[model samples]
Target: MSQRQVVQVFEQYQKSRTQFVQTVAELATRPMNIEILQNAGVMSLLRPLLLDIVPTIQQTAALALGRLANYNDDLAEAVVKGDILPQLVYSLAEQNRFYKKAAAFVLRAVAKHSPELAQSVVDCGALDALVICLEEFDPGVKEAAAWALGYIARHNAELAQAVVDAGAVPLLVLCIQEPELSLKRIAASALSDICKHSPELAQTVVDAGAIAHLAQMILNPDAKLKRQVFSALSQIAKHSVDLAEMVVEAEIFPAVLTCLKDTDEYVQKNVATLIREIAKHTPELSQLIVNAGGVAAVVDYIGNTKGNVRLPGIMMLGYVAAHSENLAMAVVISKGVVQLAITLSEEPEDHIQAAAAWALGQIGRHTPEHAKAVAVANVLPRLLEAYLRAGATEDLQTKSKKALKNILQKCVHLPALEPLLHDAPPNILKHVVGQFSKVLPHDSKARKLFVTSGGLKKIQEIKAEPGSALIEYINTINNCYPEEIVRYYSPGYSDSLLDRVEQYIPA
Candidate 1:
């Protein structure tokens, strides 16, 4: 063959290989084509191309593999079983920046599916290669490697510790401080994924001076970067009291409170969640949030938002109030209960309603004053209504019932207790009756209203079993009213003599 003819044939071969990989990359973008591509024995065809003499063909093949593995776990396992991972990991260290990015992406795609799949990537020494990629001069390589490391570490603690063992933490910490916005975002997210698995892991990130760097990024103008920074802080704060205190010591509170009103809803939610995590550990932490007006910011966020965005705000109130009666009062002073009552009554999702119920319970469970605060918002009836509805979730019913019992045991407000007598079921009715038993014996006007409003008649119809607390409360309330009136309202009395004017006799 002539030399010119041989060169023409080689060029044709490279062109076809390039077209095949590029076509697969385009087809991979549509999820519906994954099975079609796999059925065409794409993995068998693509495996040999990972080591193509031309770098574009190699990188594009890796890109196609990453997309296939990213679509689902079965395809990810296909990449693993086809022996594609080992070849990619081997090429990852020797490749150019684009190939390194593509190979690291494939590793991340496989590892993100499950711990076993991730362990397979680890077994192929992908972490060592990816860690080396993080040290590359190219920013894109660093970002891709950080993202892959985060995915590998995200599955569980063992895998996370494995990434730590590969010496990725200090590199990732340096990546967060880099001038590139995308790198900072990805690196912060990677740090959060690393630290979220355990207290010890979080301490590792903290010891690397991550909190100070992350806290400084909170002031960055980029919305996405701010989201990751707040997320890292929240994860670190959630692990333990000492860790939570470390986050607070960074002086991120009032700055985070300002973010509660930020235009970004996620920023608002993460800020509330971070505050809640800090407040959840101890009374002193709760007081720190209260002192910073964190409760009020959360209250405003809850008021303006809907669905899941407001959930963190609602829970922050619960955590703050759960710490002590004084913090509970702080929530009440901020109009937190009213917002929670609104959410419980007006929100569409059952889980959100359940969260609001749980929050209101926290606010009202502390003391009589707190109970009255919740009662004044008219949350009691809404809670009872939600609890009794047939479609309410078991979680909602359980939380609502517990809230009722908690507040009712502390409530001194007679007017709020009256409406519940008309509709409460036996488990909840006992609480209503018990609250009345406490108040009616002391207040004559309330006792008179209890009868005139047919509340006493409502109690009479309950016919609680012998020696039950409902019956005991009934007896206590019965003694507070006139015996004749009580006997008239008692079961079977009206049936006995209402029609017999000439001869009236009790049953």
Candidate 2:
């Protein structure tokens, strides 16, 4: 088709505005086509038609601009320069209350992707107008204004600061205080942005008495609202250590702990993350989390969590475990937690199992009492079995190796297996062979596998196995372990190891 034919067809289509609206909807996801349509000059002519259609056509025009925002810079420029903003602003002021919200909503969509335009709207006293819209009895208009203010505040810190300076904080805080969960969510999110730039603004929220409201929102029947409140809690948690203290002091840990088990992984994650953040910087709060059954909760959840939740869960648990020996010991003492942790070592998720292993290792390192406890727990063999099951894949193997290495290095002395120096478990003997065969260099005294009761002797017997995986396993260990350990320690049958052992052996 010729350019004029394309233009004429488009014009004919625009004349039937319902079809035009549907056409724009169809093109909403096709940015390039939206650009082609917009740059084709059809949108410029359609703009006047859209304004004439006014409230009825505003959504379609705004949506088209949003799509055009992606590639048709000229169209974005035109929508900004044309009658759309004035019409949107006027629509908010129109006597028809329903259209007031509809117009503000369209403006929100337009401003979301076009920050310069949003800021320009703000500059033209749109901020004040939106603040006024917030006073309307209609929840929809109030919601839209909250969103628009947030988008504007996010894009223009200066504008955001100005809004706060103009007393938007108290209004937004009250939005969170509103009985409606949807409005509360939007209000909290907008407030989060405001808090990010000025953590001090949290006091403004608190002074508005949002803390108790937020704490109660955590118990909201709607899971989505609970999540929003939790997110707001986290954002505030990022501020004054005092805020986290207040949250914890409110006996809110149990509620936050309940969120750990929420079927919604996003809620679980945000709650887990907030717990971690609070526990990290505040020892008093960390102790409270510990006392409130936080450690046991995390250990239980790590066993069942998937995807993103697993990693963050592991990280938080690890941080807590590493942060305090008492916390680590608390987890270790929780009923069946060792068994739970051991079971985690068998999961398909390498990071999850690795984290479990790391936490166990840290516990073992922090308190030597766990060495025998862990050995009798039979977690080591389970980990080895998991390693063989999933360790063939590169990612899984890295996780497995790191976890195994940590457990070995941290165990320091595996007393339950000390008798193994005389009678080794077949698989433990095989593991010894594997470590020796790899010969991976070991820099630290802790990397030595020989410290386990019969671990060194077990390697010798494996080397003697005429046709065993033991031989290959030893070879692999040799390739990876420190040469001195292999050369000097492998000598039950090696002249060099005997001499070196004698020299190092104290009288």
Candidate 3:
């Protein structure tokens, strides 16, 4: 039928009979017929049908509006502009389950267009109505209401806060605990959206008992659900230190560490990311990760996986190393320093290289022994090279320079001394020489080897002028081991002594 024919049929049926409105309602449900109905300016006509005494016309008209709004944003905005939201909100409380479900479907489509339209729906008090629907007997109505709320809450912080303020969090948590896996997934996802907006909002979800539910769900062997659960936990953990501690208090490390070895790459990456977030700046949490074998798991992934899967693991190792001296030493004990250095030196991707450099820098910030471990891995030359390479981003350069400075200032092992003397920038070399004077004891083998390895000659060349720190350090080393230095450079220097010194040097 043409637009005029549809309009004429509606006009003839106006206030005349229920059968006429029902006929038009049935026609509105068809996709091909919506254009004709719209051309007839039927949105105004459909408004009264939303309140029709007959349940069939009410259900069909709401379903038709939903279908029509699904076609494009203009129709959805038209539905909102016609004041359909309050009517839909009212229909959600109807005794008839069909009317409630159909109204929720329409509202979901209408509010899915944009943040402005979503706020329009929320402003009409649709959030309270949707929260009420969660307690309904019909699962379909509950699921649809949860979906609509999820769509709105996912758009922006204000709408999400609106949803939470309407007391939707506990109800959504209830939905997640239900036996139906599909509804549980939707509810979990909605809670994730709600918590992702901010720490205050995320704490609200945690206070409502989401962490326990999500932690339990993460343990399931199903890879798909585990992915969703890990992602939700990660979002929650990202916004606050308290939430991260809650994740640890829930004892989620074992399950999370298991996910690091998951066959699915996305699952592995997200789980690694969650671990990284939890380990940030919390020494106790970092130790928990280390105790649970998380450090080894990440190191193995960086060694065994390629492309995107390895990047998050590298980053996790970095976060774990940054927390404390003991944790940094743990990373060195696990050979993480060697793995990170390899990535910095050999990985083609600049992001991975930058991340590796960052992890090394963290490791280098601890005691002199920790710095010596990194230096023995032969990472300083690669860091210097990465710092000098053309086209490196400011972030890459900053990380490289920071790592180089940390190693030079802390490491006093003799084998790590030559590279600083020969390869480090002038400013860094000055710091290295000063650090050596402080860290090396007067009678130490490392001090003896420093003079034997041409360290004094290199320092004299790099010193700016007489009585500088470099020059002063040279005087201290010479005063401490004058005889050994002269014997080492003399014609009859023992090969065994030189061989012992060479053993400490990296190949």
Candidate 4:
């Protein structure tokens, strides 16, 4: 079929009543039709079919595009650029709750594509329509509108700020108090978005005494609500460190820690993630986690487990270490942590290795001695090998490089040092020297050794000390011998020299 003819056929197909059934099926099985709906000359053809139709077309359009929206921005923009928005808004006021719910979904898809388009959706009186839906409408519409507003408010900060400015917080706060999990999830997510850009709005929620109720959801009997609440809390903690501190102070740690033991891996992962984020600005909270025995759980997961669980445990360690030096050190002391951290870089999964590499970096930043153990354990070479296996990602390479530098800086004179210096890759030696310079300038031992060894000899001879006659001849022969070398190695100082000389022998 000709391309234009094919377009006409699809256009004609969209116009028939039988096509509506087929469209729903197509939307369920495939979402590409929404893009076809927006092609040049296609919207003009489809608009006539949808102009007076009972929003079934619009519902199908929303479903089609929402599924496809994440993968294809062009198709999403085309829907917003078309006139389906007003129809969706009009449907929000319909007596039939199904239409209103469908409209909410479409509005959500529009908001996802462009916040600017949401203004038109709101300008079409969708906000008020949505508010009424929250209060007066079907459960489905209420949930859909709540989810839509959450997306808009979160993705479009200005719209969220406006929504809060318009006194939407009170209604949203009420929705958070709902007994229904679905409504509460949507409400909490929406409120989080509003508070994200408006701390004052968050204060409004807090001052209105929402924390206790929200905290209860973290320990809620419903696992789904618990996840939603935890997700909301994670976002809130991002905005208000004080509130996060307050949550921890109010004994939320015990409940959050309990989630660390959930049978469901997803619940366990999210709980660990939330705890990690909250610990970022509150280092003291790390003690709470440690006291609650989170270290054992995280270490055991990393050492013995695999897959998603192991990966999150690495990220959690990084987060925990970031906030507390004690916790970072504690991770190093944990059984098999060093070995497992090295193993992570060799795991078949690249993401797991990346997380491990990141955690190792965090450990190095907090404790150089522990960082040395990790490096000398051959973790540095393992990480470099993983970096090669993993394709180019600027962040991964940057983080991996920082971790490697820390390892080198701490262990330059270690037993593993010579191998890294001689047998290791040439680039590895260059990196080691680069990192060594960063710390070596401040090291008296390094400075003394550099001057005593003539500074120009191969690093292989760096620890070798000449006999007294040789030293005297060198001091007498070289006009510019370093002052410390002359002062320490002259005449009667021979015994002191012999004492100093024995300290650096390779054996």
Best by lDDT: 1
lDDT of 3 by residue, 450-507 (tens): 6667775565455466778767865665566566664555443578677788887776
Model 4 lDDT, residue 152, Cα: 70
lDDT of 2 by residue, 16-104 (tens): 77567658757766755765676567556555644554455655555555455434445546667765667567556653555565556
The superposed Cα distance between candidate 2 and the true structure at residue 155, in angstroms, equals 6.3
Q: Whose TM-score is greatest here?
A: 1
Could you give candidate 4's per-residue lDDT for residues 1-507 as a string of tens digits?
A: 899999989778657744654464365445555444444344444444434454566555445444544335564455567666666666667646665775677667667656766675666667777777787535667788788777777756678766665556677677777767788878877776766665565676666566667786787676766666666566666565786776676567666777766666666766766676666666676667777777667776566566776665677777777666677777777743574565565577666666777777777665557667576666766667565543746666666666766566555544344344443444455555444444444666765554454341333222224663323323332234355644554445668777888887686
Q: At residue 314, what lDDT does model 4 achieve?
A: 74
Give candidate 2 misplaced runs (Cα > 4 Å).
Answer: 1-42, 49-96, 110-125, 153-163, 196-198, 335-365, 370-410, 415-507
| TM-score, model 4 to reference | 0.69
Give each model's clash number.
0, 30, 0, 0
